[model samples]
Target chain A: MVKTHIVKFVGTSNFKMFSNHMATIVRLAAQQQQQQKRGMATLKAISIRLKSVKNIQKITQSMKMVSAAKYNRAERDLKQARPLGVGTKEFYEQAEIQAPPEDEKKLVIAITSDRGLCGAVHTGVSRNIRDALLADPKERENTKIICVGEKSRAILSRLFANNILFVASEVGRKPPTFNDAAKVANEILNSGYSFGSGRIVYNRFKSVVSYAVDQLPLFDKNAVVSAPKLSVYDSLDENVIQSYLEFSLASLLFYSMKEGACSEQSSRMTAMDNASKNAGEMIDKLTLTFNRTRQAVITRELIEIISGAAALD
Target chain B: MSAWRQAGLNYINYSQIAARVVRQALKADLRSEALKRDEVNVKFTQWKDGKPASKYIVFILFYLVVL
Candidate 1:
């Protein structure tokens, strides 16, 4: 009876041990499976992010190409207009010398781009204009602003909305023709408030990557008011001068628009380049995790097989 | 002779079981370390720039328009 009891006790203990060992194996397997799931989820998220980054890169690249093309055309146009603009300025200066004095109000036409993407282009232009306006001791009441581009309107409207006499939005997407610019110029000239001078603020595209905030005086105050002899024009001839004035303004608007577009593209390109580099690093990490998980699975299997074979023997 | 052979088989089984458990533990540790390394690599990759891409886009646009 004692011998039977000892045999039964040992059998029960052995069975319990086997059950515990199986339980441990099951638990380890479950844990590994969970880890794999988590790793896979992480990898999926990374891949999604990478795809989005790639899309952004493509868009930025296209924008860069478009901007480059626009910049080339704009550069050509600017070159063509340079000689004409200089000649006109010289003629105006000579005419102003002989013109009579009159009440003149200063008009500032500030040009900015509609879209935001180019780094520092719009902000720089706005800051330059603001500084110029503030530095002039001339009373704020005498200063009038003509904003070109939607972004310029939006920004300037906040501070000088009331002072904004006119906004030209059409110039943002395409280069404003001479006719469009002349309309703005004529409006300023006819606004009943006599202005002494006109100034244009715009980004002068120096290169594909470089731009400058250029402030140019369109008309001199003293010359326009102090000239002794004024060229008197009948209504019909005055209409012709109006057209020419508009043409000049359009040329300036066109230049600003093209330069802004170029700057936007270059900035986007740099941003996308950084994103691509980051995606590459993420892929490397995910690949490592995948490899390690696979190796761990194999090691676990090998251990289980070796233990089972020994138990069979 | 039969009793000795049985005892030897029991001992070998126990040793194999112990080795299997140790190997499983080692595998677990290796897997955990690999996961950690992967996480670190992902983090390093994600934050290439200090600022988010969206913010950078806004900054660039503002620069182009205002500058």
Candidate 2:
């Protein structure tokens, strides 16, 4: 019986890591005439695995709750600031500004979160920028990257190492404030990269479950100044126009950051909720398997006892 | 009266102003001493007595009760 147990256990390589204990018990019971030991061992294994799955469910459920709380405030913040971003962009359209000249440097600011596990959020932004660059190899060479989150930086830095201007870490650790966006905008303006135009690649929060990656133009200093409709505005000093450009850039970044933050929280909540549900379903399946196996062992033991009594008679 | 309002007319207003000021001051304490002091360095710890030497309030209460 012991030899049979070892052989049976060896064959149970296909059993799940969590199910290994159950498989061990099943193997031990393969040739045993009595049933108490095997039943206890197998039952113990199933219970242990069930407990772990239940713990996982608890963790996922709590994480979902935390993100759901954050989602509400982030949604409100994005809604409030979205209009200002629209207004800033409209000013550029009214000024009849065009895209930067082919010769000038292009900048892409990829906004992402420092933390991940929020349902493939950063990949969309990274993919969009990569695709855009691949589509235009000419612009790719001339382009520089400013990644707002470590996640995006890790992804893009590998491919566009030389083109990276700088990386801002510890972003979106909390709900983004305008000050946070302002600091990043200030860094870009001070870097003196002399980029002709800038583009922001961010996740647009469409609803609770869906988001889309999109890009918005951060009009260049030269483009804004050279607009044909510039003459319509009262005469302004070069320094003033430069400051206005900086303010607009900061506000646009703030709006995008808020929207992206909201999307992150909502997506995380949904992902965690789904994980908890899947864990529950797995637990249910395992419980069913455990019951069926236990019942079979019990019935087989009963039949063996009855047959042995008949043989004795 | 104008000077009084500048200083926050009564105790309630004055306390409110103080609370706001304290909050702002605390908010700017970005590199908090408490966080740095409490940071875990588990990898290189000496493992003295197989237990932590102190855990803030636990240390104080132990002295009060045990001694």
Candidate 3:
């Protein structure tokens, strides 16, 4: 009878253990189901984001190709135009000629890309312009801004609506012609807008990863003379100087446009590259979660089978 | 001029050198701060409706934990 009682107590304890194991299995199964559903949802979302990123990458890649083609041509023109522009400035210095004091209004021409996928290209140029303008207290009252791209125009208008004089659109995509730049320049010059000082703010492309914000002086030829001792016109004829100045202004405009294009292409490429990499990473993470949830479900099933076998024994 | 002369030379005080280095470091810090002023003013406009790109990773981590 004592032995029988001991066996009964042992059986009751085993039964309780079995019930606890079953409850744990139920709870685990429910948790696994929830986890699996969440993992699937995450995977689906990641796939969708990946597709969108791919489309963006293709668009940015095309833009880079187009910009590259335009940049090459612009760079050639700039190379030929830079020396002439320099020579023209030297002539003005040697001649000791001042642009008529009537043209005393300062003009700032800020160039940026029309479309944005380019990382920080537009922002950097805009920031440089803002900083330069704010640096000089006198510039605030007399300064007029001429924006080249639509993006730049929009930003400048929002920030300084009262100061923007004009905006040139759709010029960034194509090889900017001297005629187009001259037209913009002529309008500013003719509008009773004194060219007291003019500056062209744009990027100078050094490589795929680096660019510089270069401020080219548009007015006051003497500003170009960094040293006081150097002779301004020790090397050129008066006629050459006149021709060179015209060509140089045209070239400066062209170079800025080219450099801006190059910077835009590089920036877009980098942005897209990052986007694609991020998409890949997301897909990987989702895949990992999906696998883990799937394994947990299997583990719960294994636990149920083992518990059932033990009960049969 | 080699070993014998080198051994007889007076020991140099490093405090003067340390002071010069400290002054140079301070000057560099000032210059960098001036340059940083131009960079810091440019504010990045954030997307109003959606989560920021940086938050996406954190959201994924939370999702994984729940799963």
Candidate 4:
């Protein structure tokens, strides 16, 4: 009975402590609210902020709509470009073309866009490549990078320094064209820097909600020429093989660009949509706060008038 | 979401796969003509990199006529 009484007394003291803490919190909150009642300046400031927030919401909502529209056309272009890219990819797979040893020279083409605000679409690919290269000693040796978008170029240039061989921009905006890819590949080919094996690094759009940093491999001539089953191809000459490499490079780049475009557009659409939603929520919260402040001001004014009248009486 | 986290082993480059299968249906060779735009399907669009000045349009028109 004595022990039970002791436990009860301790419990009550704990409860009292908690209640006291809550009361102090309430008092602090009341003090903060009273401070916020500083007459006109706070009210004016809130109104200005409210107006700006509303305007920002409007702009983000419109940007979301524009991206949604562009996303549809980009999806269509991606669909159209796919069939054009399939054959060359198949040839490499079926031929079981050898890939040069990882230690050998490698080329990675990063596909991204110039603009941003699409939730790290460009940085995801570039950073992934950078980290991967840093992790692998073999990969770090003679791994040249070609950046296909301005954002990726800017980022990877800072990270990779001399490793960036070519930078291609003005891509991923329009429905990607085969002509553009061909031109870029030709330009790189003419630039005279070569690689053992090449890969196109890009954002692969799996669905409206998902994307992946993907690599489409392009093996070099030595690797392709020495494929264990290359005899099955029955091709004639070295020139055919070289042209085949060029053409496949172009086709794959074209298709990768289209896919990147689709991913970028859809990503932008979703990112903008989320931004607009967040802005809307912020506006709602700000409006409620503004109304509360206004009410406090009015009540304070009424109280002042009544007290002044009482004094006169 | 990150792409690497979402990637599955079954994943393939769908565009390249589709391109391979559509050649016979389109009645065209996939190699030389893969990236070529046929004359009939070609289009020309006039676009300026920011806002085009009035002189730029006139110059473009003159260049088009010359072509």
Top lDDT hit: 2
lDDT of each: 0.52, 0.71, 0.56, 0.69
Listed in order, the DockQ scores are 0.00, 0.02, 0.01, 0.04
Clashing pairs in 4: A82-B15, A83-B19, A86-B16, A86-B20, A212-B3
* lDDT digits (tens) for residues A1-313 of candidate 1: 2123223422422223233443454455446557767433343433443344345345545655666666566666556656655555565655554322353467777777566555566777777767766676463556777766666666766665556666655554654443344444545554465555667887765665567887655644344434444363234243344344444444444444445555544443443343334334444554565566567767878999999999999
lDDT of 4 at B55: 57
What's the distance in Å from true for residue A165, model 3? 0.5
Over B1-67, each residue of candidate 2 has an lDDT whose tens digit, in order, gives 3354456333223333454455456644653632332221111111112222234657799899998
Return the candidate ranking by lDDT, descending: 2, 4, 3, 1
Ranking by DockQ: 4, 2, 3, 1
Q: Across residues A1-313, which tens digit of lDDT does each residue of candidate 2 receive?
A: 3234323323332213325554555454443425555553455556565676677578778989999999998898788999978888788877888865664688999989787768778888999888888898887888888888877877887677667777777776667765566667767776777877779999999999999887778877778878888876787667567657877887888888887898999988887787677677767876885787788878888999999999999
Task: Report how far residue A173 has shifted in candidate 1, in Å.
Answer: 1.8
Local accuracy of candidate 4 as per-residue lDDT tens digits, A249-305: 888988888888889888888777766666576567767877887899899899999
lDDT, candidate 1, at A227: 46
TM-score-better candidate, 1 vs 3: 3
Q: RMSD in Å for candidate 3, one decimal? A: 26.1
Task: Point out the higher-scoring one by DockQ: 2 or 3.
Answer: 2
Interface RMSD of each: 33.7, 18.2, 22.2, 13.5
- How do the residues A1-313 of candidate 3 rate in per-residue lDDT, one tens digit apiece? 2123223422422223233443454455446547767433343433443344345435544655765565566566556655644564565455555444555578888878577656778878888778877787677667878777777866766666667776666655555554455545444444465555688898877777788888666754333333243355476444334334444555566567766777776666665555445435444554565566567767878999999999999
- List residue ranges in candidate 3 displaced over 4 A: A1-104, A220-248, A297-313, B1-67
TM-score (all chains, Cα) for each model: 0.53, 0.71, 0.57, 0.72
Cα error, residue A231 of model 3, in Å, equals 8.7
Clashing pairs in 2: none
Q: Which is better, 2 or 3, measured by lDDT?
A: 2
